[model samples]
Target: MRRHVPGVPLQRWLLVSALVSAALIAGCSARSSAEGATHYLLTDQPTGSEATATGGEGLLRVQRIELARYLDVEGIVMQTSDVAVRSARNHLWAEDLAAQLHRDLAQRLSNQLEGVRVLDPDQQLRAPEREIMQLTVTVDRFQGRFDGYAVVGGKWRLLDSEGEIQAGERFQREQALTQDGYPALVESLKDAWTSVVADIADGLGGAWGR
Candidate 1:
């Protein structure tokens, strides 16, 4: 009979343990990579009117826009019902919600407001020597519904830096989603925002005696 080799058995046990540890490490690495692959989405600026030119209204500043507490998170929110919502688990915003909304709203207003230079506090534009009109939008309900409607609605106030109101009103828009998924939801939000901004433009123009 051959003599038993105790070291051989111990070595074999150590080898098996090492292999198992390596496999577990690889699995964890793969899962981490998959989680990191999550896609982020951003809002777009709505197409502005071609005929509307900046009628030399100087500079319009969009500052201090805000989002609702629930919708201000990184995830995209979906309205499940009249009082319920769901935030996307594997998707998020590429930028800050308030920041993106503020910038995009400014862009849409600038695009259609004609030669009127729309300035955001975060942007590089200079406030003109002309009277600087300030606007702040408080988004109370901005989210996509289960029925494929992207709703953007809230109260906005136009004012000067000194807090004098130029125009104040409540605005809302419901833009339909022709498709599904995040891309479609984003487009819907953009459309809704465009409509709302158009309303703002009209209101501001009227306030300015345009």
Candidate 2:
């Protein structure tokens, strides 16, 4: 027969059970906190608020936007050194970076260039009679630098409907972050990108015949 052993006292058992439950709850809470991430959108306003059309005006298709491989990831990238970089573990893009760039650039172009409607890669159908021009861009660098500046480096070319290059140039811009952190970095990036759009608009003015 099994020897009769003193069972844990009722009060002691209750206290031990409560302690175990509390420990489990704390563990789960810590795990949840560790796994949660914050997402940020590139645009200041909602995506739906971004207007892609200029009331069927002159067409300018923004296409062939190639971003650096490192920048294509979900998290925002930061250049730790000339040869080293790291992506944020807790901060991430709210949408695809490429798509967000295209849409936001197109919308900015539409606003910058009068009488010209901007079309992004998403626009598949072309207007039959409207003259079309395209802007192809390659972004080599788009990240926060260790020097505490947000940088955007790239090249853009304007091509006519017949696939002839009209005007193009290599460009790079940097904006100083007013404060630290990812939000400030993103804002500086937006300002830098807007400067790029303004340059493109100026180029378009000289390149387009109409």
Please give the RMSD to the true structure for each candidate, in Å.
16.5, 16.1
Please, what is the whole-model Cα lDDT of each candidate in the order they appear? 0.68, 0.71
lDDT of 2: 0.71
Top candidate (TM-score) = 2
Candidate 2: the clashing residue pairs are none
Give the range of the ten consecutive residues with the poorest summed lDDT in model 1. Answer: 15-24
The candidate 2 region of ten consecutive residues with least summed lDDT is 15-24
What are the runs in model 2 whose C-alpha is more than 4 Å off? 1-35, 46-57, 122-127
Stretches off by above 4 angstroms in model 1 are 1-37, 45-56, 122-129
- Residue range 1-210, candidate 2, lDDT tens digits: 112225644443333333233323433565644877668887764233333434556678889579988888887777754687766655678898888877777777777676776776767665446767889988888887665678899999998889999899988998877664678778888889878878977888777553
Which tens-of-lDDT digit does each residue in 164-209 have in candidate 1? 9878899888876665466667777877876787788888777777
- Clashing residue pairs, candidate 1? 53-114, 53-115, 54-114, 54-115, 54-116
What is the TM-score of candidate 1?
0.70
